[model samples]
Target: MESRSRRRSRSRNRERPYEITISTADMSSKMQTFIMEQVIECLNNRSHPKKMCRYIRERCNARYGPSWDCFVAREYYGSFAYVPRHLLGFELNGLNFLIFKGA
Candidate 1:
């Protein structure tokens, strides 16, 4: 059974709007908007960063290709090597979203 506080917490999350800002994107603008939607929806359902990353990767892979990789974190750095026109970095609800396909 779920506690009342837990349920309320989830309800609050679902009610909040997620704002997305593109930090750096090598991909298309259409892809950026699509990813923003995916990220927001995933965030509504999942509370963990790893789960969010996997969710975004799976979505991208289904629509684009299987090489899709996603990193969801509050802070990220240290060299990202990805294919041309297949990398996007953004901020969604305060977390850094980095999606790319390996070269």
Candidate 2:
């Protein structure tokens, strides 16, 4: 089988546009763990989702390019289930508070 880099190069030279699909399952265990760690740190800091997204983009761009969306989405959804219900609402500082408790 051809290596991924070789396949990419071949596709680039072809006239047809090639679509590459990479799922979380395709990532290495180390990469998945690293991404999860970053997500946990951001959530623990109570950073807004938008800010978290930006941070993810900046941190992951070099390695994952524009494909970091899946990581962010997975983390956000996981957070919803893990975060306390009281902290799961409202938008503040342009950050959607996934957990907000009403007084």
Candidate 3:
């Protein structure tokens, strides 16, 4: 059986056209679900903090394509006066911890 890494490498050149129409409600729910599941999976499966951060950041980039920075800024940066303290590994509560515990 081929490994996940091999599968990903094999698709490096596949240019998929962007044609999916997502409503605002659907996009919001889908992004939230995708983020939560990926974050949980990375936290549970990864053994290092940096690795987990990279995993999530990469997932965001892949999911949003060229607009990842815009999404991150809107979802995480622009709304806050400063970078969230939890992103620096402070003790946080509930889903906040799950979202921001890593680097």
Which candidate number has the best lDDT?
Answer: 1
How badly does each model clash, as a count of residue pairs?
A: 0, 6, 0
Regions more than 4 Å wrong, model 2: 1-24, 63-67, 70-103
By TM-score, highest first, what's the ranking? 1, 2, 3
Candidate 1 residue-wise lDDT, 1-103, digit = tens = 1111111112244667554566677877687667777777777776698888888889999998889988888897868678888887877667887888888
- Global local distance difference test of model 1: 0.73
Residue pairs with backbone overlap in model 3 = none
Candidate number with greatest TM-score:
1
How far residue 60's Cα lies from its native spot in candidate 3, in Å, is 1.1
Candidate 3: list runs displaced more than 4 Å: 1-27, 67-103
Q: Model 1: clashing residue pairs?
A: none
RMSD in Å for candidate 2, one decimal?
16.9
**Candidate 3 TM-score, C-alpha based:** 0.40
RMSD of each: 10.2, 16.9, 14.7
Which residue pairs show backbone clashes in model 2? 86-100, 87-99, 87-100, 88-98, 88-99, 88-100
- lDDT score at residue 90, model 2, on the 0-100 scale: 22
